[model samples]
Target chain A: MSTVAVMNGNYAAATAARLARPEVIAAYPITPQTPVVEYLTLFAAEGSLSSRMTEVESEHSAMSILSGASLAGARCYTATSSQGLALMYEPYFRASTLRLPIVMNIVNREMISPQSVWGGPQDSLTLRDAGWIQIYVEDNQEILDQTIQAFRIAEDPRVLLPINVCYDGFYLSHMTERVEVPEQAEIDAFLPPYEAKHQILDPRKPMAIDPLTSGYLVMEYRKKHMDSMAAALGVVEETDKAYAALTGRSWGGALDLYRMEDAEYAVVTLGSVTGACREMVDEKRAAGVRIGLVKVRCLRPFPKAAVAAALARVKGFGVIDRNVSFGWNTGIVYQEVRSALYESGRTLPSVPFVGGLGGEDITLGLVSKAFDEIVAAVDAGRTPQSAVWLWAPRKGVKA
Target chain B: MSALDLLAEREDMISPGISACVGCNVELTLRTVMKVLGPNSILAIPPGCMGGVGVVGWNKQSGAKVPVFFPLLDNTASMLAGIRLALDAKGRDAHVVAFAGDGATVDAGFQALSGVAERGDRIIYICYDNEGYMNTGYQRSSSTSKGSWTSTTPVSKEGQGGKRQHGKDFPMIMAMHDVPYVATASPAYIPDLVRKVEEAMKVKEGLAYIHVYNPCLTGWGIRAEESISVARLAVKTRFFPLYEARNRKFKITVPVPNPLPLEDYTSRIKKFSHLGPERIAELKDLAEERYRFLEAVSAGGGGRA
Candidate 1:
């Protein structure tokens, strides 16, 4: 591994793409994600990279460029966040359906309803069905490390799906941190050149791509897509193990269960908030409370089984959601964990805590309060509801 | 001109079993474009006749020897820019051509096209102007010329519901970029079309625009065999002038003759058959007015940057 002095999340991502040597880099400047493309252009200008950078008018066009590039048998990369991802809605779905192994890094931010630009997982979660393999990173190091692993996981012949490596806006993207960038030869041996089982434009042979078909054909196509996605679970596992061997860092499967084995109470969350929750767990344990934390690294192909195993023995659970499902009463993660437990033929009274949305600071105190709620329920020998909103402020607290 | 003989011996680049409908002018347009671009080009096709005709299945391609990248309908220009970039990264310089129908070019794909051209990505953009959304079954498009009857522009009992807007002036728009090359040709004028394509291919930078006048036999209700003849008549009647804009200068390739009356152009196609005598006269006057403006431009200095 090589130590680059220091870099922001966006530049690190761009450097990762450069090291991976993607053939096509299509990007349009959007806030938070803009510096990624700008740095890529800098790399291109200095002749440090050989990839082509397309100046697209919008995020929609940026994704469309990757779709074409992917078909042409190029390892393609793009960057966007918030409304940019929303603008790319149509082709984003197409890229995943076609199962092109394009890699993209999304600096996650909240979508506009009341109209604000701040950080959250809402944008990437909203694209949950886009058939993209979504991985959330906790810090700049994870951002750089996961960006490299993402290409391996997505381009795995068994998977053949697009990947979105999500990091939080401003918090992770703009912040500087020390990251270990692996050697070019190390990446070369680990990831390998992208050789597709099928390419849209191979002159040696002829084929048809994207034919319009009847409803039944589309259904079968969807089934095949789902089957491929299901197949990706194994590919992701194998690639993570291989990555760990090469770097001495094992990012346990889709979800990482931290200290949940013997704990009576657990809290689950994604992204950098995992660090704060872990800290809260340490602090609560010093006070002699039996509490643990679960960090969901992969939000898509969600580790339902992993979560079930982690929470099977726990008495009470709380989910820290940095984003809320507008129409739902509780947090989105709470709904997923609840459904997973229900599907697994087990029950855990999980409280949903919504906080840190739109760049709001998710303090350890807030997380400690959630632990207090969960521990009180378990100690009182009372089962909480299937889910309850934990940190929603009361009317008097509003300032 | 001898290149036509060389092409004659080669099998038609677009294979016979492709999905283009029987007697569709797009078939000829595709054949002509493939011949001009040769076997080494990469085509960026979006939704419309060209896209439908080209892509058949995932990883399945048509008869063209070169690669064709089909992006979403509205993003042909941007995708072509990407294709050019991809090729450049490999140290391989090849033509990146965006071939889309009038609907894809003049409507949804407009903003992307504008961006790519302004960025001057090395791509050749061709709008096969068939004047309507023929693939989706004869719906109206921005390129549907005034007085044309389409499924959406049904002929009324009072005969007033033809296309309300004039066809968009794409060549003018391309010229506005002061691009290196912008030319208009028809399948009927094969030699001229081939010459323009050859010239555009030699240009190393910036965008090259070619607008091909493709006649719609099904939508326009003309004989399938008369597609070429109809396009030729369009040029002769000054309804579709043959011209080239290079470095922002417009040169009328086909000088206006004692230009044939609008009737000579309209009477042949059933689309314009709905026109009354008075409407025909109005159409004739509009065509002449457009011709005079173009002629004056040609006479003074043929637009040049």
Candidate 2:
């Protein structure tokens, strides 16, 4: 049994966490992500969720508190955005290294310096190698469903790693959409009661949880963590099927292919921008252009084989990134997509385009323009000259 | 509790073969604290000499028979608070403790410590005061006493090898939080420290804080044998007064009548050898000011109870 309601992404994520019934939730308030915390507090206050809510001083303390709770054998949760996520970097890495299956919602906001509160995937993509199983959500419905499934994948006996379910701030987090939230009974059946296998702070069986591993064993711990991530790659698919069997919905497991069959060229994207890409593909297809979209959902435990196989038949692909991997000039996803292609001996005329940054509108027009560049590059029989930056303000030219 | 009971705890709870140096007062404090905390204890040890020395190491056998968790240096209190709440939620009676040092408690970790106290978290926070950041090679911590020589406050000029800023009055600060229990114990006084730990373990209301005086031989430039003597002089001279605050009622646990001169305590440690008699008098004034403040707040109402 599930209820259909018009809700924002944060509310959907909060509903999922409530249904999942986390034992402990410690989070600090940050822009675009505060509503999730607020909603959880409402659940705790209204006698809905029995989760213990710990209001912390900073993002660092929030993660640290959750780490303690998770290691002590409890299902834990927390939420943060850009700077808040960066502030939690220390314990964020520790949470994964300690193998605590904590689920965090990162309402993706642009990283600052020229301070911005806008939506972007850069914040979560930057921590891809932090030993967290990161997945980007397409919309509010996906946000709700994936968060419930994330616990199942994260707490898997073979993959006791943290999960960062990222959804673009404001674009999806603040925007209301129709989300079908499953019943608590369905959630329980989907995500069984968390039983920790690795470590639990029990007095009867006393043992050090995170001990000082020697240099000799440091590699051993890292190997195990990485192997757990590899295991999660498989668990992500299996759990998505399980979640669909329970809820009648799936997040396309790892990567979502949008009309790529017999397509001449495709562009890779994730998050809300994927919505624009899908629209662009439809418009281009109606106009007799063979343009397609590949939404790389799981950035960590990256679907290299899945992506490679998806692109193996396609002729040319362009990567539309909302983030720029500085100095590398290419976008973060561009590097991974290119590697996936080269690994399978299938390098096409790939172009990396940076757009929709700092909440800038990544409209249907901009996505279509990126697809045009891919088509032109394929026709020219050459790769793009350089990475393209869209919707730039002309210097010294007013409006 | 009987002395035999405490001794039995020593034999049973404290694991041997730790690599701590001779006369490491923190090691003695840890061994005794663990005895009272028992097997049902889960210790969140932060980055400090007590945690790093012989208690835990690279693939080495842990010096704790009970569960030990290594949290970051500055977030021990909050970490232990999380562990405490988790155990509480599970209906488990595990006593979670944060074993930290002067640097971790007063300097880097002060914000987290204050956060835990403000949240009224139920955990025993034992700070083994070693004066400075001795774990990182005798660096000057905010708790490093005024006119104490640390590597960071080295002597650049002749006869000037001490920090000018006074160290934070941390225990009194904890008492100000009006926590369930706030006490100061000395490693030299095992039974008294044991009593404080037992009291803290019984606290189901909120936080319990114990600031134990553990003199560092390496940082203080004192010989190994001088550790206990130094600890004793610290209490006798009113430098480190033993006290407890419960329910906002304060008490001076160890009375110091006709206290020793400040130099009688400082002169033995080479780190304070650069301080002249005049500077020692200044330190004495500071110690007296703190003691007077504590006395004023005592439930005994001004003077020795």
Candidate 3:
């Protein structure tokens, strides 16, 4: 096992790409994503990794380059964020619909308009309908680890679709952390080379990849994407087990539950907030408070079964979303969770807490406050409203 | 990825099931583009004429058997850049090309295209300039030459003076990027057009632009058979000069030969027939201004080598 240190999130991502050994990497770096291309270029120049890097002109071109490469049966990857991700929305959906196992790393950033460069889930959340399997990472290590795992999950012939590995910009991207740098041989043994089954760029077996389809055909194509997404749950679980065997670290397939057994209260969260909530739960448990934390690692598959089981015995459940779905009075994830539990015939009071919109911090103090509200509501024989706003400080307070 | 290979493969690669107009320049442009790009080419088209016309479905165009990526009109360049990165991840090299109309390239996609070109990405951007937005009806576009009449600029009761702006100088604008290659060609001169495409393909790196002056016979109110004649007149009258820019060096490929009077060229098209003395003078002045700008560039006046 050799050790290689990277300075920034971009460098971390590039190192992951090198270790993952992607065959084709097409990308155009925008703002935060530029460092990724810079490091990849350096890697390619130094011949540390054997990969072909196409320096495209824009984020849109970068995504399109992958569409062709993936369809041609090459293991493909790319990175972008904010307006750049918005620019790539069109093909983002197409990549998923065509079931191309292309992996993308989105350095989550807020969209421009009174423009800000801070970290947020705005970019990846906006593309929820693009048919890509999106996973949120809380730290640099998760960013590196999830990125390597994304290819395995996405390229599983059973679940052939694109994946977006998202991490908070500036926070997780620039912050330094101790990431377990896996050896190349271990990675090679864990994840096999991408072997496309039906689509290929070989002149010997020619095929037209993206042809126009009628409305009916379009519906069926989308249905297929959904079906495959559902199939990914099992694949993710299996892959997690396989990866665990290789790395000796176990990450949950759909949801990572921390100290949930015998707990009466649970907090549903994703990304970096999960880490803060985990700490709070541990502290709360020591004080004899029946509190636990459930971190959602996979967002696309919805993890309905796993979520239901996690919330099965909990008395009061609350969901914290970094993104808001206006008019729903709840975050999009809250809505999905409610629907999943409702369909599973489970009767429980789940409160929706919308916070951290546009890159606001999700502090442990906020998690404690949310728990207090839940406990007080439960004690007072009330479940509070269907949705609640958390950490919305008074006017003049900086987010 | 040579022009000749692209031309030779057109018949076999691109099938003929598209919904393009019977005499559409876009069809010809797509045919030529796919032929030269070879089999490993990824085609990213927008929701415009080319997307709607080039390949409708699997059985539609059997001509070029390659991967075709269709994105929304405004996102072609940006999406292509992403595709290039993904391809690079696999350690396999592939060419990515964006083929869009003048409206898609110069108007709706201007910012994204400019950003892409500025970065010097390794992809070829080809604009099939057919003067107007023909797919959405014959609407006048920025690329529409002065005094040309379209549905928006229909013939006035007095029968003179329609639209009055010179076509946007996109090739000149692209030269500012100092990209690896830039050229102008027309289907009327297939061999020359193919030669430029061949040269652009060989670079294999950095941004390349090829602006073709494709004539819309239906929009121009000319007989389908007069497509070549109209194109030749455009070149002869110096309205659309042919040239190439490489490594910041501008070289005029087809110089004005025995330049014909502007009236002789304008007399043949109904769109230009309404032009009176004053409007004709305006058109001539615009053409002369364009000619001088290009001539200056060719002589190394525009920061080019």
State which candidate has the highest DockQ.
Answer: 2
The residue pairs found clashing in candidate 1 are A207-B60, A207-B61, A208-B57, A208-B60, A208-B61, A209-B57, B249-B303, B249-B304, B250-B303
What would you estimate as the lDDT of candidate 1? 0.79
For model 1 the local lDDT of residue B200 reads 87
Per-candidate RMSD, Å = 3.0, 1.7, 4.2
The candidate, 1 or 2, that scores higher on TM-score is 2
- Best of the two (1, 2) by DockQ: 2
Candidate 1, which segments miss by more than 4 Å at Cα? A213-221, A377-399, B19-22, B53-66, B277-286, B296-305
Per-residue error for A308 in candidate 1, Å, reads 1.4
lDDT of 2 by residue, A169-287 (tens): 99999999898988878888777889887887777777776666678788888999988888898999999998888888977899999899878889898898888888889999999
lDDT of 3 at B36: 65
Query: Pick by TM-score: which candidate is best?
Result: 2
Q: Candidate 2, which CAPRI tier? A: medium
| Top-down TM-score ranking | 2, 1, 3
lDDT of 1 by residue, A1-399 (tens): 766558888888988888888999889888889999899999999998888777778888888778867776788999899999999998899889888899999999988876768898899888887889898888887787788888988888778889999999988899898878888888889878887776555444444456555688778878887777777777777778998888877777688877876898888888978888889898998898878888888877777887888888888778888877767766677788888898889766667777777877777777778788777766676655433543447588752
Q: Taking the tens digit of each residue's C-alpha lDDT, what string does model 2 give over B1-305? A: 58557766455565576767887888888888887887888887787786676464346456577777788877888788788778877878788898899888998788888899988989899998888888789988888888888899987578876798998899989988889999999988888898899999989978999999888898888899888889999999999999999968998888786788878889889888888888888889999998888888887765376
Chain A TM per candidate, in order of listing: 0.94, 0.98, 0.93
TM-score of 3: 0.87
- Which window of 10 residues has the lowest lDDT sum in candidate 2 chain B? B54-63
The sequence of per-residue lDDT tens digits that candidate 3 reaches over residues A1-399 is: 646565567677878888888877878777677788888889989999777676666676677667766766678888888899997887687778778898889998877665877777767886787788988877777787778888999998889989988887777777777777889998888779988885654445655555666688778877888899999988888887887787766678788888889889888888777888888888888888898888888888779888888888888678888777767767777777777788779767667887776667778788888877766665555654546778858799764
DockQ of 2: 0.66
Candidate number that wins on TM-score, 1 or 3: 1
